[model samples]
Target: MKRLALTTASLALAAGMAFAAEHETTVRMGTEGAYPPYNFLNDSGEVDGFEIELGNELCARAELTCEWVTNEWDSIIPNLVSGNYDTIIAGMSITDERDEVIDFTQNYIPPASSAFVGTSEDADLTGGVVAAQTATIQAGYVAESGAALIEYATPEETVAAVRNGEADAVFADKDYLVPIVDASGGELMFVGEDVQLGGGVGMGLRESDTELKASFDAAITSMKEDGTLNEMILKWFGEDAATYE
Candidate 1:
């Protein structure tokens, strides 16, 4: 009788574990599907980029089902707070100001340099009209750097402002501007010294979602340990981009 009861208990436990695995938690990942190489809409209009792939991997590792959600960059945080999405996987940098409203996973990408792209090689970086996406670190830097700051809602618009001569240069992450400058055919070139801003990028979650944050943090740590995160970073950002030491 004792042996039979023990076998029945073990079977029941295995069945319960199977049921739990089949019904994993679903998490919505929000991104600004506009920042290329980081996150963007592909030719088929689906969200596709480094973050999308990385977010999916993290979700799988954490045994969570993920749904991608696209939000405008300016309102990304507000929407996350309002429950439009469970977490922000957008290439958001970790900063004390942002932490006041939401918690963040450990840094995924390392701190990167921001650079200025201008029509002319000699374009004035300071005391000149500079364009930056609103609410970005580059925008804040431009505003306080003695430059006449012009803010745009989208990163594309900031680049366009420089092309149209509305602004002398556009200030943004060097990783974002590298391909654009190379594709500009000499129309746009990097000017002035590179500026490092903000801490490394990480996923943003509401402070209440401590469990969710832990899952992602662990997934990120695993990727970093096995060199998979560095591989993905280089695949997207190229050889010159920073990686874990």
Candidate 2:
């Protein structure tokens, strides 16, 4: 009888320890470490970007310790669902299709979409055109019109296709592609007015982590209120680009 009682006490103590560890509030964050100005490896080979800074700010606001892990963009969602990470701070857009699989925090940035086209005089993709990258929302826009589509694996590849006159245009997030455009030496232009994608970049987590989601949402809200978010935005994208509502 005494042995059984001791066993029971031991089990209870183990359970308590597990609970404490679970609620210890350490956030394991994931990022692509490829998307620049959002999350990427800097010249010093260190992980540094807008999302990285924002993650630190959010952690501070929530009083949580954060550890960042770099992962490929395509695998980020799957790995998060498999418990490889606690949250994804990658510059992931909050789309309804993605929401069906994982939960996302409230948007922390304004949505900005644009199209890039080659500078060649013969290349013209204007007024309702197709885009490279079929899985993207831009592909959906192209499919709506039954237009011929151009597809590629990465934004850089898509932009290269446009520059090479293989593709008419590449639709992508303005913030992600704007730097590439400037570096292309007038080889690309962001045509037409910006398209509001109706979703902003946010952190992603497993659907079962409701408490963590709530905590992250609250932290983001606090950062916004305290001007920490705006400050970080300015630091990365300059003052003009920092003017986000």
Candidate 3:
């Protein structure tokens, strides 16, 4: 899930392509198969993650035949517009900028916080080098926060930027950072208060695909209403994660 917030040009292109293929029955779900717990490639090189499992369930509920497609975060929206995929099932935030280009199903995941992390607890919070994945919300925030923002193509590189002293800290989703910090064996720790950004995460569809959007919206609502959504949250993001209910 790249914070690759939506783009206007890409969204328009995607809408046009989708209109031409509106009658297609097979749904291709696009995702960044690099963000863990959201969507990522398993050791077997298959797309697997919290969003993957949840997406499969949603497809089943919608009675749609779903196929997974991996894409880079930076060009995800443009790719979707080009008919590279029919829908985006990545952990994409529902923001007005994104809404301008593509339609969204009702939020599937609740709002979540982004965390700051570094090797030392006292790492610079301002005016210091900070790293974030390119096109992500974290990168945007860092750029505006007066920090020296070094952007990378992938989340893994952002973490690498901090470890190699290219940056003093990294800004990223708390859930993504938690496992890294835990596995760092005391080499890393979170610093600074968590920053909440964007609206809840949702599935992205072509603006013209109201029927597809409605189908997924109904499925998402069913999960939230039945508590299955919250269960998936606990399973993926831990009990402390905020739930819909």
Indicate which candidate wins on lDDT: 1
Please provide TM-scores, in order, for all candidate models, with all chains considered together.
0.90, 0.80, 0.89
lDDT by residue for model 3 over 47-148, one digit each (tens)? 999999999998776667789999999999888888889899888888888888888888888888999999998899798999999877788889999999
Compare candidates 1 and 3 on TM-score and give the better one.
1
Instruction: Rank all candidate structures by their lDDT, best first, as comma-separated numbers.
Output: 1, 3, 2
92-196: candidate 1 lDDT, tens digit per residue: 888899999999988999999999999998898887899999998899899999999999999999999999999999999999999999999999999989998
**Residue-wise lDDT of candidate 2 within 1-245, one digit each (tens)?**
64664454445434433443678856789987877888889899888999988888777655567898988766778999999899989878889998999999988886656454555444455543345654566666665645567766555677777666667677777777778878878867676556666487788989998767766776666566556787888887766673455
**Model 2 TM-score, 2 decimals:** 0.80
Reference-based TM-score, model 1: 0.90
After superposing candidate 1, which stretches have Cα over 4 Å from the reference? 1-24
- Clashing residue pairs, backbone N/CA/C < 3 A, model 3: 14-81
- Which is the winner by TM-score between candidate 1 and candidate 2? 1
Which of 2 and 3 is ahead in lDDT? 3
What is the alpha-carbon lDDT of model 2 when measured against the actual structure? 0.72
